[model samples]
Target: MSGTRRLFAELAILGGLILVLAALGPFGSYATPLGPRLLHWALYLVTGYAFFRPVIAAGSALARQMGMSRLVAIAVACVLGAFPTNVIFVFAAAGPAWRSVTASDLAGAYLQTLIVGATVTIVQLLAERGAVPASPAPPTPALPDPQPAAAADATEQEVAPALLDQLPPHLRGPILCLENEDHYVRVHTLHGSALVLIRMRDAVAQLEGQGERVHRSWWVARRAVAGAVRQDRNWKLRLIDGREVPVARASVADLRVLGWLGDAPPAA
Candidate 1:
């Protein structure tokens, strides 16, 4: 489901749970016997669940990115989140009763909550780990020999108009290609650029079929690169009208494959 729909659904569920809990009888009845205490615990659990769910999810995602096993990450995140979760429960419940909560009670509750949250997180992570395959290392490509100066200039001139022709008419001018925080790509056209909301890996795949990634943040039409300049160890691709792009180490192979570094004529 869309994030908005999922958020609304969670909110609806929380509202329902709150209404049900609030309708339950006086605290004095529930406080006396073990059964009443258990009910209060249940209430605390339900109330705390909503607040910690997102925290756990975020932790899991971070762990996954760091190459930790799903199980381990989730467990760590959930466990860490539990203390705060239960504390929230205490603060939330305290207002209605005006009872002074003792330090020891809060500390014990925090520890208990941490244990429970950690246990739940570990179990969930394990379940998730079992469902996914092991990740593979990304493949590396071989680099090409540098192009000779005279020939490279000629190649640049030849590439520009050809690349421009291939682009949709509307995107032919003032295009700004930027990396979206390493996650996705933003294609800026003459008017404006919108976040494409696509994974960088997927964007690379698609662009590889159409052009070449000349820089970490830039993809160029096989025909769009007007020329290139080497300054120290870095190289920059020159586009029509003196536009320049920095070549990323990761993109060098693809740039070579598209013959972007090959010798070409200068634009007249």
Candidate 2:
């Protein structure tokens, strides 16, 4: 399914689940009126999903680059995210009187929300992992060659790879990078970015060594690196379009091999 359609479907499922949960009124929420109870759970579930989904996705990607296991990454992400999410939830739940909120209240709420968040994140991850089949043979499409760009006015333009073809025609300019966002792979070109429901590994393979995997969730084309930036101990490639793509610490040696960086001391 297309990325947008798949997202809608997932939201629909979550919506239905919320309705069921609200009706059942788990915990002491049963005492609240139906209308308020429904609203409360909807706010809780929807907000949790929207907030933590990206954190878990990005955290997992970073953790993989750090050589941590996926489950360990998810656990760390949930633990770290729980505090901020709980704070927001409490403030929203307690509105105008937010100042009355106490540390104990936050502690109690954090534990409860952490369980729910961890459960939801894990289930979603497992579902995604199971949905992905073993990688099939890479598709063969005529990827644009670097040589053709010198003669920009050539009548016979090289076709973009199968991955790039998935983008809308207008956004099919030279690909600057690819980013793994949740279950979708975002294809970024100078024109713009659009997400496709493809695995990051599969997407990188389709590039056929034309691009470099600078991070677990990011792949960058050679021509796209306009410069490099060193931020403290971390590094990133400044893309031609002015976006910074992170360089995984684990992949630093590989980047050195590519000569993207030179002997520069990290910030003191």
Candidate 3:
């Protein structure tokens, strides 16, 4: 589904569930029928509006960094959110109803929520897989032929040394790029990671020849990508050291072209 349509659907579901809970509230005696209905509707609007900002912000950030469709993330979040929300309603009504909320009730509610979430997740995964296009194999770069012994000796070589030496000894190893809350780039390398007082773009430029930007906040060594997994409608690129990077839709094509998504043996 499109992002906007999915968002509207989530809002509708949230509203509907809130209404259902309010109507079924603690023997229906904790509030007048009208009062519960009005309260649910009002809370839906107010809380929904309040949560929308952070939800959108987080979704966008994840989408950019992880490469999953924002719509899928939002839908999953909404489905998972229903249970806690219903529990909140139960707790809120407990005091007024003079009845304690029981473990059984909470357990039952959580089980139901899990079932619903799993169902939604499975359906979305199937839909996304069906929508994936069968793509052509990517082209491999050509290698040059070796020179003869005589020519090799005559050739004046001004070979560039490894860039790894430029960095401190401790900072040399597999690197993970992270975007900080303050919008700065944090580089985690094998020797040790550090938060550079620089923008992500600048960091990327500096690390240009060393690694590729696999995600918005991730610049990984080309050799680091160990495998790929289809999670719901999204793809995650797994690194050799167990780091997982989200593959964005915009980058999917490029990744494929770079042979990142090709049929290859899975990492051990």
Reference-based lDDT, each prediction? 0.51, 0.69, 0.51
lDDT of each residue in 1-268, candidate 1, tens digit only: 3446545555565555444444553334343455655556556646555545665567646543453443466556676677668777776667766368777767867865675455444433334334321112122111123355345434533544443343444344333243433333555432333444466556556444335655445665443456677778666777543457678666666666656665662222
lDDT (0-100) at residue 164 of candidate 3?
Answer: 31
> Model 2 TM-score?
0.56
Better of 2 and 3 by lDDT: 2
Model 3: per-residue Cα lDDT over 135-180, one tens digit each = 2222221112334433422331111113333334445444434443
Q: Model 2, range 1-268, lDDT digits (tens) per residue?
A: 4446546766776788689878998868889999999998887777777767775676767564664555677778888877777888888999899999999889878876786577567656655544432122222222334445324312112433677667766566566788776566878765677778788888877765556898877898776676688999999887666678888898889888777665431211
In angstroms, the error of model 3 at 83 is 15
Each candidate structure's TM-score, on Cα atoms with residue i matched to residue i, is 0.35, 0.56, 0.38
Better of 2 and 3 by TM-score: 2
Give RMSD (Å) of candidate 1 vs. truth.
13.3
By summed lDDT, the worst window of 10 consecutive residues in model 2 runs over 133-142
Mind sharing the TM-score for model 1? 0.35
